[model samples]
Target: MYRGRLAYRPRSETANKIREVNKMKEGIHPNYYQAKVVCNCGNEFVTGSTKKDIHVEVCSKCHSFYTGQQKAAAARGRIDKFNRKYGIQ
Candidate 1:
């Protein structure tokens, strides 16, 4: 509903008929290309995309979650902060 007005929706039969009669506009969609994705950690992969080339800083190969390093680093930071605040070695 818009502005408290009931929304208009076609019935199932009408909707099916409209779908059969209408079709997607040609030449309006971007072309899919075999895109080359380059990661900062030297990881490269090919995937379908509208763009031909893509550059990224991180990839699954070196991501902290994939390597299981983010949690350790975060915990170490918290522990250090707590220790400093309490003047503990």
Candidate 2:
């Protein structure tokens, strides 16, 4: 019986080389700087972005999907359609 021993695989040398070489040229790309994100719920955080400052309607701290508070806004639309079909105010 012939058996082969397991061998460790080495990382590829050119794995991320393409990305490094294709980086944006200096002064041509948008300026990346520290920007502040202000959420409507008063949650503020600093992150790196091209804009100096950003205002977001929702964030992880207060977003419906993240906080498990999602409401069916589509349900209101359905209700409106039903009312229109039935001529109900």
Stretches of candidate 2 off by over 4 Å are: 1-24, 71-89
Query: TM-score of model 2 relative to the true fold?
Result: 0.50
Error of 2 at 63 (Å): 1.1
lDDT tens readout by residue for model 1, 1-89? 45987879767898888988799888999999999999999999999999999999999999999999999999999999999999999
Across 1-89, the per-residue lDDT of candidate 2 in tens digits comes to: 65887889876768678768888788777779999999999999999999988999989998777876455666778899999999999
Question: How good is model 1 by TM-score?
Answer: 0.74
Instruction: Report, for every candidate in turn, its global Cα lDDT versus the true structure.
Output: 0.95, 0.86
Q: Which ten residues in a row have the lowest lDDT in candidate 1?
A: 1-10
Error of 2 at 7 (Å): 28
- Give the range where candidate 2 is weakest over 10 consecutive residues by summed lDDT: 67-76
Cα deviation of 55, candidate 1, in Å: 0.7
Cα lDDT of candidate 1 equals: 0.95
